[model samples]
Target: MVMGYVSGAVVFLVGLLGGVGLGIACRQYWVEKRNRQTREQAASVIAEARKEAETIKKEAILQAKDTLFQMKAEFERESKESRKEFQNLEKRLLQKEENLDKKSEALDKRETTIGKREKLILQQEKEIGDKEKELDAIMDEQRRRLENLSGISSQEAKEMLIRMVENEARHEAALMVKKIETEARETSDKKAKNIIALAIQRYAGDYVAEKTVSVVNLPNEEMKGRIIGREGRNIRAIEASTGIDLIIDDTPEAVILSGYNPIRREVARVSLERLISDGRIHPARIEEIVEKVNLEVENSIREAGEQAAFDVGVHGIHPEIIKLLGKLKYRTSYAQNVLQHSREVAFLCGIMAAELGLNEKHAKRAGLLHDIGKAIDHEMEGPHAIIGADLAKRYGESHVIVHSIAAHHEDVPAEDILAILVQAADALSGARPGARKELLETYVRRLEDLERIASSFSGINKAYAIQAGRELRIIVESDMVSDSEVVLLSRDIAKKIESELSYPGQIKVTVIRETRAVEYAR
Candidate 1:
């Protein structure tokens, strides 16, 4: 029974061992199948990923090509615009260069013409000097012959010797004067070269707009009708009161005032402005306003003159001259106010005179009064320079001042340093930037030309350019020009004007010869 039980246990142990080995084999097979399946799935996923990556790469390349094309088109468009702009700038530059070249050529020609004129002038001066020397030799010969004449007493001989010594002294004096003049001229020339720059640097002043015409501003368009007034009575009254022509036209909110006299025009402007402001539209009111404005203007003129003199450190001017100087406040040449120009000229003269060791006060005085005649030049006939000189002489200004005034414009030769100094100062003042208006100057020159042409004929005492250069009236000397000759003179003047002047419209020429006998009661 023990053998049978041991065999059964070994059998049981073998059976259990077989079962365990079979299960182990089965588990190993299952694990291998799962690993194979996972490998296959991973391979399929890698293939699909590679296909998607290739599609993305192709799309990116196509997008990059499209972007490059757009960039190229944009660059080409910008380059074309840049080229067009450069071409336009090049054309403008070329045109400007051509204009500059033309201007340069014109300047060179003018310079050559001036050089030729200078050479001719120098030649004429030398000839005149030689003639003067010959005259001097002839006079010396005649004097020697007079000295050797026969019938002579001791006293007479002594007198002749005295005369000889006097003549010798005069000659030496002339030589000394010439030497001094030469030195002075050299010094003055050197001073002049630097003086303009220095004076401009040291002095500066404001300028005024040239008021050739006056216009009154109105509060509204309705004021225009009021200015014209009932049946134009107010307009006529204002014109009669102010001696100015008033035009009420299509211009809105403004009334045009026309007159040649700056003072009269200023008065008219002020009066009209006052009337407009006060809302008084009547003939009686117009006259009252005008008269009041006139007196105020006069007082203002006097005050301006006094103020100018005080500012320039000049004194003792005649009262009448002061009034005339004050009148300069309303005077304008080009765009430069006459009073302002005078002040600037005075300041410049003082500075230059100080630099040259001259009387600064005298120079300033002369410069201040240099253009004084312009204040009333419209009322007088003659060059403003000559008129100013006459007025200066009449008003007890020194002979130096009078001469300087006359010579400043070369109406007479500048015979002294003071006169020359005034000329330089006047030129400097006038030449300052923004001092003049070319158009106004041109108009003035035309009027001047009209008078100058009439005066060029002999025996004409005075010439007046009236009606804005449309008419020229000439006053001939009674003794020099007859009635028939006056007609001929007028014809001659008309023909000369036509030939010499470039003008529009017809210019009427009238010549009058009148005799005046003056008697002053003692």
Candidate 2:
């Protein structure tokens, strides 16, 4: 029974194994069939996609062909238009060339015509030249005949005509010159008088005449002996220290101080007076007093200069210049106080400058410094005007001011209106009556000399000194002195006076020539 059971079990196991294997085979077959179907479907889809790709490529190629054909046609059309434009440009160039050829031909013809005309003009010029030569010869013949008939050569006739014309012209020019000179003189005289009168009227300055000597009154005659000191040492010391001469003359209680230098004379005078008052007279005391008085006088001079400048409203003067200007206070020119005269000149210059519309301050400055040289004129050898100008220039004065100072006395040429104004003011200041004093005999002698010098001229009939000898009027015989000769005569007389006499300022020389015709009416 065990064996049969084991056999049946084995059979059952075998059947079970077979059944499992068959099911596995059936499943693998089904999977393979499904894979085959899937592959077939995939292959069919790929083939259909390939056919669509081929159809799209053919359509693209046909579109490319059509685009290329259109581009070619457009290129051909542009080429045709370019060719047509080229043909038109060629035709225009040909037409321009033909026109240029025609114009060149015309220019050639015009050149030929111009050449013919130039030849004709040259022939005409030659003919005119020959005709002119013939006319010149004819003119020469006629001139020779005329000259012979006139008994004078052509040159002589021309000279005579020229002389006649020149004489007439000279006479006319003389008349015109005289008329213009008369009118100018009238106008200038009136204007000058007005200006001078206004200047004199505007400023009136006090006149002080200065002298080279100063007289100091002493207490008694005994003071003179004491001043003279032992062995005359005191007076000698005073002279040595002060550069002045002390004259203790036999005058009553008066000591006369004498020096060419007014400033030194002043210092000496003051020092001696101080010594007399102090009653101490010796060389040492005399020197001390002189030194002190010199300082005082110098201070006074500076003050005077400053005062003059202040009065004139001028400032910025150098200290040394101011001191020199102060020295003028004691200086005298022809007995007129130089400082006073300078002040008067300053005022007059200022007034006249204002009237003439010039620089008033500059005028006043020039006037104030016009006589600065007078301070040191005794030491320096030159005209005071030139010395003053040099001082002003050295002290940094303006060129105009320097020139004005120099030309104030005509030492230099007056180059500007300010120079002329300074001259006029200086003249007015010194030339005024009583401004300067001279001996009466000297005055009469100067006038007589002026008249005599003027009368010495040949044509002068009479010579009269007028304006206090400032002017010499000479009457000339009309027959002897012509209108032109009077001018020469006046100049000669002026020159003679200048050489013969020494006078202050300038003297006017006037020559008068008059013609008189007497006719009786019955």
Candidate 3:
């Protein structure tokens, strides 16, 4: 029974194994068939793709060729049109050239005709000149014959007539000139007085005491000794640093800083004040304070200058120029602060310019900067007017301002009314009563110079500077100078006086040329 069961089981197991093996073989066959089908589909797809590519390539090539043919046709058509245009243009240009050639030939002919006409005109002019010369000779011969018949030599007759005419003309001209001068003086003097009086009445300024040196007040008189220090070392250090002399005298609570250089004196005064205020009297402290105060003072100077310019309504001034103007505060001219003088000049200029119907602001600006050179006149080597003009120009001042400043003293001749106004204002300000004083030596020298200048001119018999050297009366030999010549002589004398001497205002120059018949009186 077990053997039958084992055989049945083996038969069942073999059948099961054979069935599994057959199923595996069939599955492999199906997979291989499916792979073959896929390969075939892929090959067919590749063939179709190649065919489509070839068709597309052929279509593209055909289109390209068609486009090329169209382009060639268009190029040919454009070339044809361009050739036609070129030929037409060339033909027109040739025609124009021909016309131009013809016009040129015609112009050449006209030029030749003009040249002939000019030659003919020149020939006619020469003939006319020849005829004129012939006529002149004939007239001269006739005139000589007429003079001989009249029993008068040509020179003697001319002299007699000229003398008679000169006598009449001299009397008439003198009368006219004197009348015109008198009228002009009458009108001008009245107008001038009015303007000057009006300006003076309008502007009023307080008198300020001018100080050439600055004084720094100390806390006590004992502090003065400390400033002197051991062996006067402190004072020496300050002088060396500032180029100023510190005078620690018995004056209570006061130390005087003296220097010809206003800028140096100002710097020294500031430094000393700082030192006294800080209570540090050592050399190092002195130097530090000095340097700091100097910088501060420099800034103050610049601000003061800028403020002055602003106050006067001037602009475009350089910072350096502003600093220079600030230095004028320490400058004194004739016991008046130069800065104040400049301000006064500026005000006077504005008033004068307004009255004269000129550019008032520009005039005021020029006046304000006119004496700027006084700030550094001691350091520089030239007239303050010229130096100031140069500084104004360098500081970007207008050409008009520079001109007016330069011409304030007539140093370069007044170019405009503004320049003349600047001069007049400056003269008025400086020449006012008690504004300036003249040294006796300078006054005498100036008078001598005036007389010498008048005497140097020809036709001057006696030259005297009268009226406290304000008036120059020059006498000319009556035979040498006529009345008109006397007027001219006065002008020349005035010009020479201006050139020679530096005086306050305008000087009166009188040239007297008088003739007297002394025999009848005897």
Candidate 4:
């Protein structure tokens, strides 16, 4: 048993040693496998890292190259701009130099021309001064020579020559005047009479006297009350608004308006007609119609004046003067319309001026304005001529024209031909027969009857009107009456007419004494 135990222990010990060697071998193999795996992993990670670093370095180098290229392009463009600006500045400087050269050349030419002109003027002035001194010496020599040759001194000779010339001039002027007077009588008088008679005979116009009162034709007796209105409120409104007095009396279908102002009467006439037509004759309506018609009548008056001026060939007259002239349309002088008389005067003046070789325009203007003073003569206190002259001066007429107007009535001295022409034309127009009518026909009849009374004497034959029927020209028998007896008959006829006549102004008692003894030579 002891032997067997030792052998088995030996066997066990060998087995144990072999097993330990195998275990050690297995452990070494496992460790070697793990170390190999770690080495391979580390190699793979190092390869990946080196590849990423190479790509990053390549990107950085490409970015740097692009940046350098862009910087070079910017520098090239900036250099080109700087070169262009420098070239422009060089061109401008060259042009300025060229302009300066041109200005310098112009200045030199102007200075040269000025110097030449100045020298030429100086030479001319010197020559003129020397000539003037020579002329003065010549004039002095001539004066000395003339004084020695003449008998008297220079001043005494001059006076004698002037006196002799004056005497000769006066003698020649007197002879010319005598010749002109003789020639004028032979040619002028027959021509003047023919022209005046022809003009008067050609133009025959009707004369209507426009009174200050206008009559309104009413519809019926009741219509008059309608115009008067309730309690005469209509009439009162018309008079107060129109400044016209309404005369509503017992006369049926006829109302008379009595007013000194014709334009006011005309206004009331129109307003009453309008009210009668409209059938609304209350105070308010009456006031409205009166105002409207008043304006219309005023316009009518202005138009009439304008027409009168146009018809008479007058121009540049004041509107106020025209209005006053229109007012004269209603005024009567010797029962004839004053405005018509003025128009006739203007026409007559124009005709006379044409025959007399005077200015027709100026003559007509004076005649038209001559009685322009008569338009306001009623309001004024004086002879119409002087008042008219004052009005003309106030209205900016020429002094000569005003003088002509004033001197027409001999109120002022007429020193000019124009004044005398106006006076003569005025007299010819006013003094014509049938040119104006008297206030009453009885007055005209009384003058006619007086002339007839003179003709009733035995020696008178062929009684006729002379000087606007003012003076009677009675043809007497030259066989029966002597020159002294004819003068006595004219005085006796004048004394008889003066007792029978009622005249406003003085009438001339003209006794034309003429004795023509009839004898025939066979």
Worst 10 residues of 3 by lDDT: 200-209
Model 4 ranges with Cα > 4 A deviation: 1-212, 376-387, 407-417, 420-431, 439-522
Which candidate achieves the best TM-score against the true structure? 4
lDDT (Cα, tens digit) per residue for candidate 3, span 1-522? 999999999999999999999999999999999999999999999999999999999999999999999999999999999999999999999999999999999999999999999999999999999999999999999989989899988888999999999998898798658656766887678668855643332222321123445788878888988998889888888888887877677788998776566677778987887788788798878887788878987888888888888888888878888888888876666566778788889999999899888888888888899998877765667777898999888878889999999888767977778898889889777765456554456677878898899889888899998987879898899888888777777877776665556665468998887888755554
Q: TM-score rank, highest first?
A: 4, 2, 1, 3
Across residues 1-522, which tens digit of lDDT does each residue of candidate 4 receive?
A: 999999999999999999999999999999999999899999899888888889989998999988898989988899889899999989998998899899889889988988998899899899999999999999999888988897567899889999999998898698658656765785577558745643332222221124456788888899887777788887888788877777778877898876655566677888888888889888888888887886777777788788888999999988887886777776565455667777877787788889889789887887777767766765666767898888888887778778888998788888887788778767666555566554245546756776787777887766775564566777777777667887788877876665565443445555454655789999
Model 3 scores a C-alpha lDDT of: 0.82
Instruction: Quote model 2's TM-score.
Output: 0.46
**Per model, how many backbone clashes are there?**
0, 0, 0, 1
Predictions: Cα RMSD each: 23.1, 24.3, 20.2, 27.5
Instruction: List TM-scores for all candidates, in order.
Output: 0.44, 0.46, 0.44, 0.47
Residue runs of model 1 more than 4 Å from their true location after superposition: 1-210, 437-522
lDDT of 1 at 486: 85
Tens digits of lDDT, candidate 2, 186-232: 76786688556433322223221134467899888788888888899
Clashing pairs in 1: none
The deviation in Å at residue 149 for candidate 1 is 75
| Inter-residue clash pairs, candidate 2 | none
